[model samples]
Target: MWTIGLGFVAVLVIYFTYWLNKWSNPRCNGVLPPGSMGLPLIGETLQLIVPSYSLDLHPFIKKRAQRYGPIFRTSVAGRPIVISVDPEFNHYIVKQEGKLVELWYMDSFSSLFSMEGESRTTALGVIHKYVRSIILDHFGTEPLKEKLLPQIEVFVSKTLETWSTQSSVEVKHAASIMVFDFSTKSIMFSYDAEKSPMKLSEKLINVAGGFMSFPLNIPGFAYHKSLKDQKEALTMLRKIVKEKMNSPGKHEDMLDQAINNMNKEKFLSEDFLIRWVFGISFATFEAISTALSLALKLIADNPAVLQELTAERKAILKARKNRNSILTWEEYKSMTFTLQVINEVFRIANVSPGLLPKALKDVKFKGYTIPSGWTIMIANSVLQLNSNTYKDPLAFNPWRWKDLDPSVLSKNFMPFGGGIRQCAGAEYTKTFMAIFVHVLVTKYRWTRLKGGNIARSPLLGFTDGLHIRITKKSS
Candidate 1:
């Protein structure tokens, strides 16, 4: 009996070893990039989500890039992924979106944003374009030149004024309130903070914490909690949709615009609308808010940078017709240094992980063959934080952007992502951040009271919370 048991244990060990390496995608025919596939099922996912408290690239990708060169392969939760930090290869992957790759996200992201079966297949092409077109119609340049510009200015001005009245404010929560309050007016037609819609926006924040985590539905996992929170959010959004469907005219907000287009676009289902709004809500609030948090901390920590930024902002105000006049589109366009400051903030904030695409066909890059159906992770943080690309990449130096070639900068800097599927709200975000810096530097000053420690679970967030006391700048 003892001999039999020993033989069985040996067989089990052999099988485990075989199974562990089996998911490594041997079909790549030894051309897979150098890296470990990690353990079975979970793979290198846990390592990917390991928290790093800094403004640079997360250690997971940084260490892997150092170990295995710019491009490497690893399994993320049993899903084989090719993570390309090579800027050249990243540029290639992004431009080849429709041809070599297609947009994709891990299950964590897919469950929240992806449409199902026919809807997804249909949405990826024309439906996606339609959505972008609608967004552009409302948020595009023409609108900015006319109305949205002044609207955003007033909203931000009042919001910051309110913040000044508070004893102290948490930057993250404060930003959430401001972004949502404005976003609702444009996107949701109207917003009441006490209403379920605004409250639901908060739920999306927790959901994003699990975005890069390993997908596991088990109760304690962040991914599971994310799904739970997402479901609740969708439920609330669903109720809002139903209410709007029954009682609404063609409302003037983005949500109503999409809803009204339902008959013309067959793929625009109730479910799809809920997911889209959920996605937009998540996008509109989280990215800008986290950026504000980081930007404020960076400014507070660097007085010299703040002084220069303040001078730049004052110049914009100086050019205005009068002190009481609002910002003009032309004035906003002239904020050269302010734009640089915003660029540096995004470079360090690194809110986006990168573009996620799936290999449409086996494609070769730098002598390695990426197997068809594999996930491609173009890590923007890796490129943005490269020592060769920027001097002292870890420091918050806005001055670094001054001398760079626009063409070269375009290649390296991709805070809004790239290619055909680049975020439609790029200008909106840039404009928002630009105006935010303008207001913060020119109209008000803030001091960090407590808790501004930075950290990232591959998802950028503050440790305790960035609390600040805001005061109006004395004339």
Candidate 2:
């Protein structure tokens, strides 16, 4: 009986594999791009992601691009996708967002972030406009100057003051904690009631890490555990929402802002509010923290760059009246070298690796056909690393941008993305990082120690925490 059962399972596997391969490709007039769709159900997924786990430059795609040209076909996460490394085509696809394509996310991503249909990617038409407007009002330029900068300066200064006493700190963990605390305060007007701030931050980090996992619900799988964590996180947020509604007189945070403006006639529920807050918080939380960690690591690795960045920060500080004065928006904007360093780190880190959008209809581009419902992966990381765009793509050189024209950089550089679906929190994330960097470079210096590695399990970040030692600089 056991032998028969095993044989039957094997037969079923073979049948499914055969069916998936035939279904993935159908004869077309314009022809699809050249590449192999490895195996049937799996379809090159493992081959593509395994090398990327250590944050390597997508060996699977790069090797094929060398053989098959820039635009190629492959399957990932059980869906057939056209991976475009062509810079011009990518820019076109992203800019033509609503007309030619619509934003798409993986099942694991939507589930892990607890943003089923609430995120800008999933929301469409009036819903998308409304969500984007609210987010901008909360974290846009005006709010960053008036509200966020002062708060971030205080929190970052207080946090780093304690760090200077420690012998060595895990930079990634430390950064994650700081960003999460600040974000929670901005969103909910307080920290966690159920868990410690650090603990909650770590939980959110895990959830974010698993957002692009392979959507398996089996026990012991990372995605499964992340789903469980997502539920717990939402539950905590819901409790906070209830408490705020019950006892709040006047609060000045995203939570209050949202509550005050919610449509009572439409009867938007607490669940809706919780999802909105969670959507913004979860997406930006890890990216901002990872950006800081990577920035620290990169600057530490490059001494000349560090010296330049420190000098810039010092000039900004000297313009202030006193040591205790908070950095003004003008001061932050004036740090040109510091801005270059940040942009360089963004390019090297490739934090937002790729943008996934689904073909709204059978779209044709460059004599190639993308079927309706197929996934279009704008490989932004790949495009950034293209030899045609940057001088030496892999090198961490901030000076490359020194003489480069801003118009040219804007055309090729897409750290946030392009078009209508671009990240709403891009400027907000940058402001948070700028504030953190201004405080650190002005008051202290850090050295990245050994045993730090980049992790790309789902997205770009550090693994085992980028360890560093911090010390105060002499004035």
Candidate 3:
């Protein structure tokens, strides 16, 4: 009994010493940033996730930012994170990617979207460049001018025509379907109302929702479900890719382009190709859908904004004498006010909450030390919502963007992010939005139904399906 008691005492003492060392203030020059790490194992994971799950980076961040300045420490997604809201510092971090910091996501994210040998981490330098080049070539402005915009116009026209018949429609849900259809069709030439595209989108979305979930394999848990669905989605995509490769059919889509462009010697395998296809499709679909839904809802609530948007669209329609004329790239660039409204939507939505970059080594900034291996979250939401940057940051003011210099705006307004890994499909997203807005405002008027709110759930979107009633516009 005495021997056992001594052993237990020694274990407790060792653990106490370790805990003290782990949480202790630095022995080096700079101090750790101010904030709590919450409970031992869980840390502030719950505190971070609750508001995030509700689609707001509130109380946890806002409250802490108030108490601990722009930089603070918290634990989330099963790792210790340094949340930096300092705009300049955040910009510096992104600019210095691959040197000072490496992009990191939760384990579940890494697992679910694992691209074999060609992941963001594994596929660095030439491999990343190759994949990005392929994506850009397929989805870039030139491609949009040649192939995509006409299809988008058709999709939007058909969707609005359907919406006009219904007494009321859930705009977000409908918009999600529309974007998914466009994305799947563009990527894989697979889209149907009751078939593959719909199923694939739902499964991929479920996988995305569980990207930050705990890596537990319990049957009912989100992570388990994500892995399960991911395998299923992968199986479906692999079969499609195999069939496409085998078929000599000359399809003028992204899949065909990728297969033709692929060089196996460069280590770009069928596995990498399929992963890239589905990953890009799923990501762009959600982003476009979320942004469109929110933009429409915002325009509906703000009559003045809607009126201005309508005027902009009407002018374009008048210029093209035929009502059914396709939107031109020149016209997309000409909708300055419409672009401002979309920018404001991006700002307020903070659609992409924070850009994650892990510190490669111990780094000091703004009189604080961030330890090596710590995850640095460049909180874009904080910058967007900061009172210092905008006159009335919370207010949905599109007009503020009218006279702002492009250079000045780019520094602060990074909805698509900045640096080497900046969103490749930004132009694609912009074109989609411009065309959708032009078509909808010209053809139909919409009013938001009661009791719907935008929720974050880690992904910015409407909670109760942005319900709206639509009616055809009188010519």
- The models' CA-based lDDT, in order, is 0.81, 0.74, 0.75
Q: Which residue window of length 10 is worst by lDDT in model 2? A: 106-115
State the lDDT at 396 in candidate 1: 87
lDDT of 1 by residue, 235-313 (tens): 8888878877776677488888877888777667787777778878888888999898998898888989888887887
Candidate 1 differs from the real structure by a C-alpha RMSD in angstroms, to one decimal, of 3.1
RMSD versus native structure for model 2 = 4.5
**Comparison by TM-score, 1 against 3, better one:** 1
Cα TM-score per model: 0.91, 0.86, 0.87
lDDT of 3 by residue, 4-86 (tens): 99999999999987885675433434677887776666677666555343434566777899899889887764478889888
Best by TM-score: 1
Best model per lDDT = 1
Off by over 4 Å in 1: 1-7, 24-26, 105-123, 213-221
RMSD of 3: 3.9
For residues 1-475, could you state the per-residue lDDT of candidate 2 as single tens digits?
A: 9999999999999998778767567455568888777676677767755535444466776788788988888887678888888877887888767666777632222333232445434434444566677678778888888888888889899889989999889877777777877777767766662365436666777787567677677888888889888888888788778887776545477787667665431324576677776777777677777788888877777889878877887677677788577778888788788778888878877776688888766778888988777788887788667667788888889898888777777657778888777777888888888778888887897776765677664367655667778899886
